[model samples]
Target: MKKKIYNILSVCLFALLVSACYDDEGNYDYHEISTINTEGLEKSYTKTSYQDVLHLEPTVTATGGESDFEYLWTLNLTKGSGTTSNKIEIILDTIGTDRVLDFPVNIKQGFYDLTFRVTNKSNKLETYQVMSLSVVTKFSEGFYLLKDMGNSTDVDLHASDNSLVDNIFLKMDGEHMPDAPVSLGLDPGYCFVDETTAEYVITKALTVCTEKDVRISNIEDMSTIYTHSNMFLGGEAPEEKPYYVWRNAYGVGYISDKGAYFSTQASLWDLLGTGKFGFPAMVNDDEETKPNRNGVFASTCFYYLDELKGRFLFLDYNGSLHTYSDLDENNEEKPNKPNGITHHLKFFGKNYMDKKSTGYALFEDENTAGKHYIYQLVLGMDPFNPIEKVTEVATSSKLNGANLFAVNELTAKVMYFVNDNQLYMYDLVQNTEELLRPTDMATGEEITYISNRYWSGSDNADKNFDYLVFATRKDGKYKVYLYEILGGKPYGKPVRVLEGEGKVVKMHYVDPSMSMVSYSYFPNSF
Candidate 1:
């Protein structure tokens, strides 16, 4: 009986080995996947905006296939000049059997070919499905505003097309932000990080809000936000929150309470580790409450205020941080660095010129009389070298403080400044100052914020005339005044007084396509 059992076991082992060796043939026990089919495959899609989320979650049906299979959905966008095209790949991981797939359809306005490939594990055969997608502009004409509403901040949408939805953020998410009831700090700004991505920074505990193709589409989903608690190199704690956030080719940077920090992306927490650098804030010994955390300048090189040192400093991409004078002093050819005027600046006007010939407006120095000097900083042919041009523009009386609203790049000559009760236009070309308009400060009527419509044509009635929008408040209502600029001066009284809601504190003209204005308001007056 033992001998008979041994003979049977040996025969079975030999059969198993033969089957394993012949598994590559069609004789395998597992069912082979011959073909794959998907039902309701969308052949074409009409995308109006980058925010349009395409419902990719489609039922994938397969026939004549084994139980173990893999599904791959791929999308390729082709862009370039003529025959030379660059392919942007979008791939979803492999999955088993029939499943639903979901993804955003946020891409630049263009035509793309999408492909779906499925493979059977048993046979290693692939079945491909092809489709086409068409993306066009829908809400491309509008301006989006991030505003402070006393208790919290909210995003408002002003659309040129009446069909587009208004107050998009509240409508889409039913909340001000993903983190509701979060207040914002000074001067929140937005920048296009890439062809499809836009980053919005409100500076509440270092939260960066990201949006994809926000312009021409209704936000069908919730926004993704990133917050950084500690952002320091060598694992050190963050010293201060950013006051102003700006972006360029180098990356995003912030003028923080502690100084200046630059990051490759919105998540500042990992900035230092991911090839980022920072400049320390000027040390405060006398203990001043409010440092001039106003404006910032950035291009290939960055220039920012050093409050404690009471001067301006620039950081180059080569990781070199020095003052304009430091560059001169280092050069042996120029021995004594010019030191006649004090190197002090309270704020910088919004830079609106080309990087090669960029011009910046600087508030010269703070004084007891509250009288401040206005200086136009012009970059020479060599961007690293700069020349300071002092403007005779002076404030009427001792104006305590003012906000640099907008810079006119059309003529590269004028800028708008908003104080408590007046709006001043400083002509850099002629070095002249003019108070364009005034408000009654007694009845809570004061100019709170201003924004420039630097866009051309679009919805603007006069293509030649640029606009300066002023946010003035009285009682409980907010009024917006759009002043047309003829030549380089405010034409007259505001051409239009727009109806504004809430306590308008901040405003920005976001998009040129819609000629829409975005402004932030507070529930209560400041």
Candidate 2:
């Protein structure tokens, strides 16, 4: 009986060993799983004003008829002129019945044909559908203005490449309101609150005020008038406050909304006031009180003096011209004065206290009286004063309130005001002015002084008029006009570029190279 039991035990042990060996044999070492079956593979292309990263779908199947599997995916850029080596390899450690691999590719603007291949443990071969993605980069070349729709206080930028003009009404928190709106000045890149927290955030990302009716003030009232009613108020008005103006240089920088800065003559009261009132205010002054009292007084309008230097010149209300460089250190404590280098050019009219005084002086060079009745001072040196000279190029009658822009370093141009409906191009070298009429300037009855400022472009180096963009009032509405500047002359007639449903406030050329135009509009206050 003992022998029989031992035999049974030995047989049982042998059988168990055999079973283990069989199991080991069943486990196959696969160099490559069969071709992986790729699912959720798709490709598409699009164009946007900004650069964007795209994500592809999660890869699904890597079937190779095996219980356990591994996956390796390779992206092959078969066709493209750019760096064709744009490829990625994804090694999937987890592969099962329900497991799916994910692959992502960053596609830029262009055409591309992409192929995705996957390998699995069983060496099974499967290919995802070849995706032909043609991403056409779409961009609008014209200028854009971003603004807050609710309180009309938050101004920002919106650019378009095409010619279609649309009114961009700011809505609080990304809500669009066509009725209640604030028009922007011009395209000045993005907009944001001049605060530490918001820093350089785009204007659209800001929180909109739930209530409106903040007092709105013009550029002039910010300094002398300390009352709230004198200011343009948006957002919620404080309850029965002491009528104190915020005094916080809130909306006082370059009007990115209008593509310009405030240039107003500083009043004597403002010069002695407690707050910094102008664009290039006094640099050294008490922060708690007012700062910087030696610069141009407010009474100027902002002008893009030079693109290369990125400096803006403005005329102070004191009849002086000041240049403010965007590349300046900004201090929140004393917010009025720009912390960068500030140049001042006082343009005391031939005689103060004479409203009709025609002549002016370049205070920076010499305070001497000059014979030329300087109606306007375009900052930067001209033939008269070659090195950093401020040229008195236009008279009030010729340019009127028409915005002055630098056609080039040596020459300044202005859209002529009144019925002549022409552009006055002044040659600093020749000391001459040329009249460029795309057509008859719209009649005075059609537009107002505050209508959209004239717009044009000049390639000073080439001595060629690049393009001319302007706006006119028609049927109590503002319309945009585009004219190509060819061979130092305008061609054909002005083509209607954009027509909007609101009152046009300002228009600007995006660049001197293109025919694009950016315009701003506000609703009619009927």
Per residue, candidate 2 scores C-alpha lDDT tens digits across 255-334 of 22112222221111121111212332321221111111111111122222222232334333232334443222331232
What is candidate 1's lDDT per residue for 68-134, written digit by digit as tens? 6677766654222111122222333332234455556555544456667777676787777777665
Q: Pick the candidate with the highest TM-score.
A: 1
Against the true structure, candidate 2 has what lDDT?
0.31
Candidate with top lDDT is: 1
Cα deviation in Å at residue 203, candidate 2? Answer: 6.9
Candidate 2: residue 111 lDDT (0-100): 34
Candidate 1 residues lying further than 4 Å off, grouped into runs, are: 1-75, 78-88, 92-141, 162-222, 230-237, 265-292, 317-320, 326-344, 350-367, 380-385, 391-405, 437-445, 455-466, 481-484, 490-500, 508-526
For candidate 1, report its TM-score: 0.55
